[model samples]
Target chain A: MNLVFDPAWLPRLGQGVLLTVQLTLYCMGLGAVLGAVLGLVRVYGGGRWSPLYWVASAYIHFFRGTPLLVQLLGIYLGLPTAGILVGPFLAGLLAMTLNTAAYQAEYFRGAIQSVKSGQMMAARALGMSRAQAIGHVIMPQALRLIIPPWSNELIYMLKYSSIVSMTALRPETMDLFGVARSIAARNFRYFEVYILVALFYLAMVLILTVALRWVERRVRIPGLGTPGRGI
Target chain B: MALLRVENLHKRYGHEEVLKGVTLAQDAGETKVVIGPSGTGKSTLLRCINRLTEPDQGRVWLEDTEITSRRTDINRVRAKIGFVFQDFNLFTHLTSLDNVRLGLMKVRGMPRAAATGRAMAELERVGLAAKANAYPAQLSGGQQQRVSIARALAMDPKLILFDEPTSALDPELIGEVLSVMIQLARDGMTMIVVTHEMGFARSVADEIVFMEGGVIVEQGTPDKMFRSPEVPRTGEFLRKISDLYGESR
Candidate 1:
C-alpha cells in the first residue's frame, strides 16, 4: 500500500484549527456567564419549589438530557419552521453554547455549594449585602473550586467543536474535523488524515490541561476544596 | 439605656425550643460572659443579637435601634455589631490582611490605604501583625482566631459577640485568644462572650450570665456567680466546667 501526504492540506487544516479555537472560545466565554447566572438562580432563587429555581432546573435538565446532535439539528432545521432562520454556523454555535452551559452550570452550582456556609455568614456579618457577599467572598472561593471540573468542560468543548464540521455549514466554518474529512475524501487517505487530526486534538488538549492546572495551583485556597483537606 | 438589650427572645427549630424568652442587657464598656452546658442556647443568643439567627419571638436593641424590627437594615446593623465564631470562620481564601480589610473597604467604603492602615492596626492589637499576609490555613488555629478578631475589630463595631471564640482552639493555643479578648475587655469594648473559660469570665467579665435549658438561670458579677450563685444548678454547672476545662488559664 502507498501512503500520500499533501502539503496543501496543512493550511486548510490550520484554518480548521483556527475555526475550532474560535468556536470553543465563544462557546466557553458565553457559556461561563450564562452558566454562572443559572447556577446562582438554581441555588439561591428562593427554594426548591420556587418558579425561578424550577425554570433553571428545567432548562438544565432539558439541555443535559437531550442528545447534542439532536439539539444541533433541532436548532438548525426546526427554527425555520417557526419563522426564525438561523445559519448552520449560528445554529451549531448556539447549540454548543447552550449545551456546555448546562453542564457548566451544574459544575458551578456544586462548587458554590461546596464552599462552607459560614463564609456567607461571615460576609454578611461584615455588612456585605447578599449580592456583594456572593461576588466577593463566595465567587472567589467557588471559582477556585470549579477549576478542576471547568477544565474538563474546556477540553470537552474543544473536541465537541468538531461536531460542527459534520453539518452542512459554510466552507469558512469548517473546523479541524471537517477539513480532515474533505482532505481524505479527495485524496482517499482516510487513515493518514484521521491519524493526523487525532494528533492535533491530543496536542490541543494537552496544552489546555497544562494551562488550567497552573491556574488551579496559583489560585488554590490551601485547604479549601482540596480533596481530603478539611476546611 | 443599656448599650445592648435582648428582651424575651425565643427561637425554635422544629419541635425543639433553642431559646425560650431570654432577656439580657449590657451597659457600654461592659463584658458579659455567657456560660452554660452544651446545647443550652448560648450560641443562639449571641446569633440572635446580631440577627445572624432570627428569633421566633422578641426583640433586640443595640443602643437605640430595634434590631428585630422589619424596617431596620440588618446589613447596616450587622456592620456595627461584630461576631466571632467558634471556628474562627476567617475567609479562607483571603490573607489575614485581606480578611481584616475586606469590611473596611467593601462595607465601610474606606479607601484602600485607609483600610490597610486600619486593618494593620487591628492585627497589631491582636499580635498577628507579622502574620497578616498568611492565609487562614497557614496560621495555627489560635492565630486564625486572632485574625478573625482583628477582622471584626477593624470595623470598629459598637459591640462584639464571641460565640465560643476559643472553643475550637487547642488548650495551649486558647490562652493567646483569651489574652486578646482580655485586652479588649480591659480596653472597655462592649462584648458578649459565650464560653466555658471560667478563668476568662473571672478575670474580664463584669457580669457572668449562666444559661440552662434555653433561659438565663442566673446572672451577677463574675465573683458573685462563682463564689455564690443564687441558683444551685448554676454553681453545679460552673464547677463541672471548671473541672473539665481546668479554668482555661
Candidate 2:
C-alpha cells in the first residue's frame, strides 16, 4: 500500500472537475427553464387530460421512473438507432438535462401547489388572466418555496453527473471519478484513490449546499418558511 | 340598466345548496351589505357577482354588459369589478405598493412611473402610504386588509365586492378597515359587502339584506331593518348575531 500521494495528478483532477461542473451547470440551466414551464403546464394547464398537461405528466413519469444511467446509455447508444446521432458530450448533456428537468418539474409543481389558494383568487380578482396570475403572482411566491427542494436537485446532479462518463463521454472531460478510477488501476491504490475522489465530491456538495442555502435565506419570505435565520 | 344586477343566482356545493335564486340590483354610487349566517352564501353572492364563483344558474350584469355571458371578456369585467376577501388576500410575495400597482400596470397597462404614482395615491387613501414598501406578511391583519383595499381602489373599478373583508381581523383591528370602507362609501363608490360588522352595515349600507337558509329573507334600509325587520327570520337571526357579537348597530 503505497500511501504516497501524487501532486502530478492534481492537474488531471482539476480538468475533470471543470468538465463535471460545466455539465452540471449547463444541465441545471436547461432544467430550471424546462422544469418551470412544464411544472406550470402540469398544474395550471386548465384541466386533466388536456394535451399540455398529459404530455408534461407523461414526460415526468417516464424520466423519473427510469434510472439516469439507463437514460444516458439510451441517449448515447439508442439515439443513433433512430437516425439521431450525437457525440458523447451532447448525449451526456441531453440526458442529464432531461432527467434534471423531470425531477425539477415535480419539485416546482409541489411548490406551486403549496402556495395558498387565496393568492390565485387575489390575482384573478385584480384583473390578471389565469396565465398572468400564475406567472406574475403565483410563480414569484412558488419560486421561494422551491429553493430547498430545487437545491436538492442541484446537489444531486453534482454527483449524479458521474453516471455520464459511463457512456463514452470523451476522456478529457470524463469527471473526477474517472480520474480516480484511472489512478487506482495504474497505481494499485484503489482505497487511497477512491478516498480522494470521495473528498472531491464531498467538497463540491458542501460548496453548493452553502451557496444555495445562502439563496434560500436571501429570498426567505417573512412569516412563511423562514426559521429566523439571517445572512 | 343598474350599475350591477344579479338575477336568480343559484349555487350548489356537493349536496348542499349554498345560494338559491337570490336576486339583487344596485345603482351607481350605492353601497349594499349582505348579512347572514356563515353558510347562508353571503360571501358566495358577492363572489358570484364578480364571477369569482360562477353561479349554477343566473346572470350578472355590470351597467349594460352581461358579465355572466361566455362572450364577455372576463378580465375586462374583473378589472372593473374589484373583490376584497375575508382573509385580506393580499399578494403575500409583494409589498403593499406592488400589490396596488400590479393590476394598474399589468392589466390596465399603465407605465411603471404612472402606476407607482397611482398606487401611492391609493395607499395614501387607505392611510397605509408609509407601509407601501412593506410586504403583506409584515403587516397586521387590519393593515393587510387596508393594503388589499388600496389594491382594489387603485384599479378604480366600477364596482367592488368585499367578501367579509374584516371578518378575519381582531375586534380592535376591524375599526381601521371599517373606517376605510366608511370613507369609500362616503366617496360614492359602488360596493357590495358581506360582513358580520352590523355597525358598518348600519352606518354605510344604503340597503341591508338579511339572508337565511340559502335565501334572502328580507332587505330594507338599515334604519327600517334594524328598527323593524319585515321577516321573523331576519329579526331572529339579527338577534342571535347581536347576542354573539356584542350588539348589532
Candidate 3:
C-alpha cells in the first residue's frame, strides 16, 4: 500500500482541533465554577436548606461511576424522549459539564479542607462574615491546591470531547479522532491518518502541560514552598 | 465595671473537661496575662471569650451586653475582639496588606482606600510597613506573627486575645513580637494573653492569672503572683519552667 500525504487535509484537521479546544475550554470553565459553588455549599452552608452536600455527592457518584460516552449518549438521545429537545451542541456541552463537575468537586473539596481551621477563625475574629472569610481567605489558598487537579481535568475533558461526534447536530463537528477515522475510511489510508491524529493529540498535551506548569510556578507561595520542597 | 467579664463558664471536649466553671474579669485597657501548664485551659479560656470555641454553659459580658447567651449578633461581638494565634494564621494567599485590610473592608464596611490606608498604618505599627505587599510564606515566623498582630489591630477592636503568640517562634524571633505587644500594652489596648513568656507577663501585665487542671489556680498583680505566690501550683509551675530552661542552657 502506498501512502500519500495531502497538505489540503491539514486545515480541516486544524478546524477539528480548534473545536476540541473550544469544547474543553467551555466545559472546564463552567464545570469548575459550578463545582466550586456546590462544594462550598456542602462544606460551609450549615443549614437545613443546604442540600448541596447530598446533591453534589450523588451527582459526582453518578457521573464518575458511568463512562463519559454513555453520559453523552444519554443526554443527547434520552432527553429528547422526555420532551427536552436540546441541540446536539448543547447536549454535548451539558453532558461534558456535568461529567467534569463531579470530578472537579472532589478536587475542590479536598483543597478547601487542606486550608487550616485557624485561618477561618482568624477571619471571623477580624469580624468577617462566613461568606467573606471563605471568599477572601479560604478560596485563594484553596486555588493553589486545586490547580494540579484542575489541569488534569482539562486534559481529560479535551480528549473526551471526541465522543461528541456521535451526536447529530453538527456532522461536521468532527474531533481529531473522528476526522482521522473518516479520512481513513474514504481514502483507505488508515496508518497515516491514525498516526497524524495521534501526533496532534500528543503535541496538544505537551503544550498544555507546559502552560499548566508555568501557571503552577507563578501562583506558588515563596518560603512555604511546594509540598515536597527541600525534600 | 469590668470591660470584659466571664461568669461561670464551662467547656468540654467529649470526655475531657477543659474549662470548669471558670470566671474572670478585666478592666478596660487592662493587660491580663494568663500562664498555665499545658491542657490547663488557658487557651480554652481565651478562645471561649471570642467564641472561637463556644462554651457549654456560661455568661460572657462585654461591658453591658451579655455576649454568651444574648444571641443578638455574635459577629458584631467578635468585631470588637481580635485574636492572634501562635501559628500566625495570616491568610497565606493574601499579601500582608490584604490580610490586614480584609476585616476592615468586609466587616466594618470601610471603603477599599480607607481600609488599605488603615491596614498600612497597622502594619507600620508592627514594623512591617515595607513588607505590606509580601505574602505570609515569604516572611519569617516572627514577621508573620507581627502581620497577624497587625491584622488584628486593623479591626480597631476593643480588646485583643493572644494565644501563645511567641510559643511557635524561634527564640531569637520572640523578642521582636513581644516588643510589639509591649508597645500595644503601652498604648492601653485591652488584652487577654495566654503565653509562656514570663518576662512579658512581668513587664506588661496589669494582672496575671495562673490556671491548672481546668481552673484558675491564682490571680493577682504580677508583683503579687510572680513574686509572692498565693498558690503552690503557681510557684511549682514557675520553678519547673525556669529549671527546665536553666538546665538546658
Candidate 4:
C-alpha cells in the first residue's frame, strides 16, 4: 500500500479539518440551547395528554427514528421544491443542527431526571418559586450530571458530522469527508485518502475527549453526581 | 391567635388515608413534639403545614394568614416557615455556607455580603462554622442536617418543622442533631418536631402530641404524658419506643 500522496493536499485537508471543527461546535452550541428547552418541555410540559408534551415528544421521535442521510437530502434538495432554497452549507448546517438537537434533548432530559427529587423539595422549602428552584438548585446540579453524557454526544456529533458531507456537493461547502471524497475520486487512491481522513477525525476526537474530561473535573462539585464517593 | 393552626386536615393516598381530619395549634415560641409509628402521617401533617403535601381537605394558618388559600403565595409562606427533612436534603451542589446563603439572597433579596454574614452566623449556631466551604457530601449525616437547619435558620422563619431530622443519622451522630434542636427550642424558636426521640420530647417539648392511625390520639404537657397518659395506646407506643431506642438521650 503506497502511503505517499501529494503534499499539496495537506492545506486542503487542514482546511477541511477546520471546517469540520467549526460545524461541530456551531451545531453543538445551538443544539444545546434548543435541546435544553425541548428537554424541559418534554419533562415539564404537563403530563402525557398535554399537546405541547406530545408535540415535543413527536419531534424527538421523528428525528431519532429517521435517517440522517434522508434528513440532509430533504433539507438540501427537498426544501428547494418547497420554494425554500438554501445553499449547501446552510442546508447541511441546518440538517445537522436539527438532528443533533433531538439527540441532545434526550441527554438533557435524562440529566434533569437524574437529579434527586429531594433537591426540589428542599429548594421549595427555602421559599424559592418553582422557576427559581429549577434555575438555582435543579439546573446547577443537572448541568454537572450532564457532563458525562453530553461529552458522549459531543464525540458522536463530531463523527456523525461526516454524514453532512453528502449535502456539501459544492467545493466551498466541503468538510474533511467531502474534501477527502473529491480527492479520492481524482487520485483513485481510495484507501490512502480515506485512511488519512480517518486519522484527522481520530486526532480531533482525542483532543476533544481530553478537553471535555478536564472540564468535567473542573466543574464537578465534591460528593455530587458520583454516589458513594461523598458522605 | 395561635402562631400556627391546622384545622381538620385530611389527606388520602389511593386506598390509604394518611391523615384523617387532624387538627392542632401552636403558640409563639412554643415547641411541640409529635410522635407516632411509621405510616401514621406525622410527616404528612408537617408537610401539610407548609403545603409541601397538599391536604385533600382542611386549612393551615400562619399567624392569621391562610396558607391553604390559593391567593396566599405559598412561596412567601414557605420562606417564613422553615422545614428540616428526615434525610437532611441539603443542596448537594453547594457548600454549607452557600446552602444557607441561597434562601437569603434568592428569596429574601438580601445583599450578597449580608447573606454571607447571616449564613456564617447560622452555620456557627449549628457548630459548623469551620465547615462552611464543605459540600454536603463531605459532611457527616449529622453535619448535613445541621447545615440544612442553618439553611432554614438563615431565612429567619416564624416557625420551623422538623420531620424526623435525626432518623436518618447513625445512633452516635443523632445526639449532635438533637442538641441543635434542643438549642433552637431553648432560644424560643417555634417548632413542631416529628420524632421517636423520647428524651428530646421529654426535655424540650412544650407539649407532646402522639398520633396513631392518622389522628392525634393524645396530647399534653410532656410530664403528664410521660408519667400518666390518659390513653393506653400512647403509653404502649412510648414503652415500645423506649424499648427499641432505650430513651435515646
Per-candidate TM equals 0.97, 0.96, 0.94, 0.97
Off by over 4 Å in 2: A223-231, B247-249
Model 4, B192-235: lDDT tens digits are 99999999998999999999999999999999997899999989
Ranking by DockQ: 4, 2, 1, 3
Candidates' lDDT values, in order?
Answer: 0.91, 0.88, 0.86, 0.91
Candidate 3, clashing residue pairs? none
Candidate 1 residues lying further than 4 Å off, grouped into runs, are A222-231
Give the C-alpha miss distance for residue B16 in model 2, angstroms.
2.2
CAPRI grade, predicted model 1: medium
Question: Using alpha carbons, what is the TM-score of model 2?
Answer: 0.96
Interface RMSD for candidate 1 relative to the native interface: 1.4
Give the clash total for candidate 4: 0
For residues B55-161, could you state the per-residue lDDT of candidate 3 as single tens digits? 99988999988888656588998988989998999888889998898888888999999998999999999999999999888999999999999988888889999
**Among the candidates, what TM-score does chain A have in each?**
0.94, 0.93, 0.93, 0.94
Computed on C-alphas against the true complex, the DockQ of each candidate is 0.74, 0.75, 0.73, 0.83
Per-residue lDDT tens digits of candidate 4, residues A1-231? 457678778888888898889889998999999889888888878978999889889989999989888998989899999999898777777888898899989988998898889999999998899889989998898898788888888898888888877777766679999999999898888888888999999999999999989999998888655666667
lDDT of 3 by residue, A1-231 (tens): 677878877887887788778888899999999889767866775643667567767787899899988999998889999999987677888999999998888898889999999889888888777888898889988998999899899898888888887773343667677777777778888888888888898898889989999999998876676568788
The segments of candidate 3 whose C-alpha lies over 4 angstroms from its true place after superposition are: A45-50, A229-231, B245-249
User: In terms of DockQ, which candidate is stronger, 1 or 2?
Assistant: 2
